[model samples]
Target: MITLKDVCFQYSADSTVKALRHIDLTIQDGECVVLTGESGCGKTTLTRCLNGLVPSFYEGELTGGLLLDEKNLLEMPQYEISRHVGTVFQDPRSQFFTVDSTDEVAFGCENLSMSTEKINQNIQKAFHNLRIEALKDCSLFALSSGERQKLAVAAIYAMDTPVLVLDEPSANLDLETMEVLRGILQELKREGKTIIVSEHRLSYLMGVADRYVYIQDGEIKQIWTPRQAEELSKAERKALGLRSFQSISLADIAKEGAPAEQGKRIEGRGLAVRLDKTEVFRGLTFNFQWGPAGKVVGITGNNGSGKTTFAKMLCGLLKPSEGALLFDGKPAAAKERLRQTYFVMQDTDYQLFTESVRHELELAERKNHRPCDMELILERMGLSQAAERHPLSLSGGQKQRVTIAAAMASGSDILVLDEPTSGLDGRNMQRLKETILALKKQGKLIFVVTHDMEFLDGIYDEVMSFAQKIR
Candidate 1:
């Protein structure tokens, strides 16, 4: 059993950020606890604390008691904590030290000084048990985020830790992919592994989580059973800033997307792309322009179905091996498309270069050569309070919004946001929806690559299913 007796922590003595405060809770052995709340509400921090990250890796002032199985985890060395607890970060790429998928899975066990024979056995077992043998020997770069996520899980599974803490494993996954994770978690739970998941996307955890702990401003506000969480009223959930507890669907989108093209303002002719001998999509043709549904287009696909490849083509990040792109009934070269396109990458950290949040927008505007109401953009994105804070210092969801705000500042005609709502709570999702609608009003051609059904249900004037086209 894991227990916290008035556990509290702060990043620095002078820092005003609420990392965690008076966190008191007990998680039973073999229980699957889910930590949830709005972005920056301290869900991640609590997970860090549980995994012995606070005061171990992150420089911080620690107070109160944190015990695991009646043992003092706070006093234990971070290395010792590793034997019992293994963490899968929100971005699986960050923790990965090797390129090969199989080797990455074995990386943790090797760290523990396990024998080579035992390591290989565990690796094979992990691959077989996780049903990810296809990812064996695969390069991490070649895999989709969901595939990489499974690899991350397989790594922790190989380590055989008693407690597994996953930080938003569903962030960039499609509904079908998330079900894979849910099944993995269910299997782990059956094996009596204590699990702690810090996530904003809650529907997938409907049956997986034994307890739902709601944290707000560093405090534990509510502890709910699965039934209570699942039965939460919509109005109450919205008021509490919780995402819908029910699994949302996009299966009906095919019916709505079956109509013929309305206009040919933007189009692709015989488009095909190859990334290092891997043909992603071939002979793809789409004439998606301003239709009755407006300008927002949602790209739908399962992981590894070439949705991101299409997005790269639209945003000029990847050149097509065959065919040409025409913009406004005129051929637009790659250089010209680059100028007109603004892509917010799935990993927002790659795009953030400025120190302060406000400076990030300023840098974007400088490159854009466009006049923008920087302060107003921040306000609309609900980031006014974090304007002076460093972009990297903010939460993952906040950093993503910062990038979108930068995209808005760029004044690009084509804005491509990859998995924009992956880490967002219900409130922030609504805010982004409003922002996207506002952008649509500005005549921007927005291509959103997402698996978020709720975001799709709210945002998407048209659905472009790469699942159908690529398959």
Candidate 2:
């Protein structure tokens, strides 16, 4: 359904450095193509070019032909080509220009001038296929990262375009939502839709993907068929930096102490936050006590249960409407807050601004003239090779990990992360868990807000549900 011939592309702002160089590729009808590469390897750039973003949204020097079925994407305006190619971006926040989930999903089709009845029908079909019917009434701002991603996918799915390009669709999903996406992809395949997914997590898509296309340095390194995929040697697997099904979790290695009983390290007292006419939560209370220092803690709750708000309150970013947050027997203030805590936001994109990963860490300026081993931390997070590259060019997973590495590098007493594992694979998840555990051993407070049960199950000392217990 899509083809690229001798494609060479470079951003107009920087004409000397090529984003995609001499790329030739083709995706046939009803095929599931998976693109694999380290961050900044031109995967996203290539996908963007397929649907006419090259010369349109992104001002870039383009030399070569891009065809969507019979129409040339290079010759058409983005609005004109969008009808034939639907795209789901890595960051849902960037993709969503609407207020609510339903509007967001229906926006694309509405632009195409579909009938209201048809739009409603497609909405129902998409909600059912994506298993997000429960989120139909939710505001886009209130959605967890995972919900936004699912909503974005459903929006594109409803378009029924001949070609669909999903760039890191699993970046913000929990396991349950990830499974929902996999099922939806399978159903689309059965219906003969052509799909191209660029992602870091491979195991989930391995069963459904027709071909695995590996891209490196703006070129296709190799393509593997399913039959030949199973025969890959250990060296080849290591070369890909992709793990086999059985491997130790990275968290286990990072942990300083084994799992132990849980109780309280800190407690929330009648926590409440109000903004204008909305009250995020009121009369909400909880307790967390420090356990053996180096164990990971997972805090979970349904959407709108005030996880991020609470985390922000804990980190002193937001003041509670009616409650007190105590750390080690003292009240937390903006000045005193920095000595005790750091928060990894749900959207890691918010924390990044430096030119490179190394600069990001250096700018953090942790005390003791000490920080986590930057090189080793980057290596464990699968970002060593991209350490010198612009953080913006990295994959969603890479960006998430860089933020994590920055947090770990901070010599603070507490680390509160909101959905740190959103874009990670099982291997990377393990590494993060291990890192948290190691911090716990050093007597640092580790607080995680997540919906990932696998990481929560064997890792967390206590599992608290915000939505259920907040009221």
Candidate 3:
């Protein structure tokens, strides 16, 4: 069993700010507990405490008892604590060290000095359990974000640790891949491993979680059993900034794109991209239009199906090898497209370059012919409290929103957001939708590259898919 008693932690970077406050919780040997909360509400910090990374990896002032089977986890060495707990981080890229999929899976077991044959067996078993055998022996860099997440889970699964912690494991997964993840979690729970998950997308955890622990502003707000979670009305969940309690599938989301009323149009004729001598997509003839109450088109496809590549192409980050893009019936070159488009990348770390979030938005605002409401944008994106903080110093979700606020300030006609809601809570997702709609009124054309079904509901004006395979 794992227990946290009166645990309070303040990061060394922000001495006056406590990341976690009075966190008291317990997990039985085989319980599956989910940490649910708004963005930056201390869920991730608490998970770090359980894994012995609070003071070890993150440098923080920690006070309180964190015990695993009556042994103080805070006193244990990181390597020793890792044996009992295997963690799959929010961003799978952070935890990966190997290039090959099979090798990555074997890395944890190899660290235990297990025999070569046994390690190989464990690797194979993990891949098979996750139904990711097709990903075996593939290059990690070549895989999609969701595929990399699958491999990350497989790597930890091979360890067979008593305590398993998965942070937003399904954040980037497609509809089909998410079902696969759900099955794996259910199987792991049946095997009696104590599981803790920190998530913004709660629909995927419905049947698998034994308890839902709601956290707010660095404190535990409420703890609910599965039945209680089910009993809560949709409005109640919304009031708490929680996502859906029921399961969601592709059919539950909007799949058709809405026709815009008299707006700018982007036409693509026989557009194709070739990377490393491989065609990502081809024979792509399409026209997309957006107008006031600006349309946010959600892009959905299987892992490695060229969603990000397409987003890059639309935003002028990459040029099409064949044919061209026309804006409002005029052929637009890469340079012109570059001038008209702004992209919020999937990895916010690559896009955030400012010392402070406020300064980031201010710099972007200066680029626009007209200025934006910086304070209002900050409030809508839920970054008002962290406006003066460095973009890199914020939580993953906060970083995601900061990039978006910068995009909003850029005053670009076409905006491409790749997985913007991956780390966003329901309330903030709603806020972003409102912001996008508000931008839509200014004649902005937005394309959102994502597979988040819950986020797709009641927001996006259309749904676009490159779901078919291309050589």
Tens-place lDDT per residue, model 1, 1-471, is: 999998877886328875888999999989999999999898888888989878777878889998899999988988899999999998888899998998898899999999999999999988987777778998888887777877888899999999999999889777876887898889899999999999989989988899999999899999999998988998989888889888878864444543543653788899999988788888888887674444888888887889888877876778999998898779888777788889888888899998899999998887669899988999999999999998888888899899999999888777999999877988898889899988987777788899998887756778878774222
List pairs with backbone clashes in candidate 3.
257-462, 294-440
C-alpha root-mean-square deviation, candidate 3: 1.8
lDDT of 2 at 1: 73
Better of 1 and 2 by lDDT: 1
Residue pairs of candidate 1 with colliding backbone atoms? none
Each candidate: RMSD: 2.1, 4.6, 1.8
TM-scores, all candidates, are 0.95, 0.81, 0.96
Q: What is the Å distance of residue 276 in model 2 from its true position?
A: 7.6
Give the alpha-carbon lDDT of every model: 0.86, 0.75, 0.86
In model 1, what is the error at residue 235, expressed in angstroms?
0.9
TM-score of 3: 0.96
Better of 2 and 3 by lDDT: 3
Query: What is the total number of backbone clashes in candidate 1?
Result: 0
Weakest lDDT window of 10 consecutive positions for candidate 3: 254-263
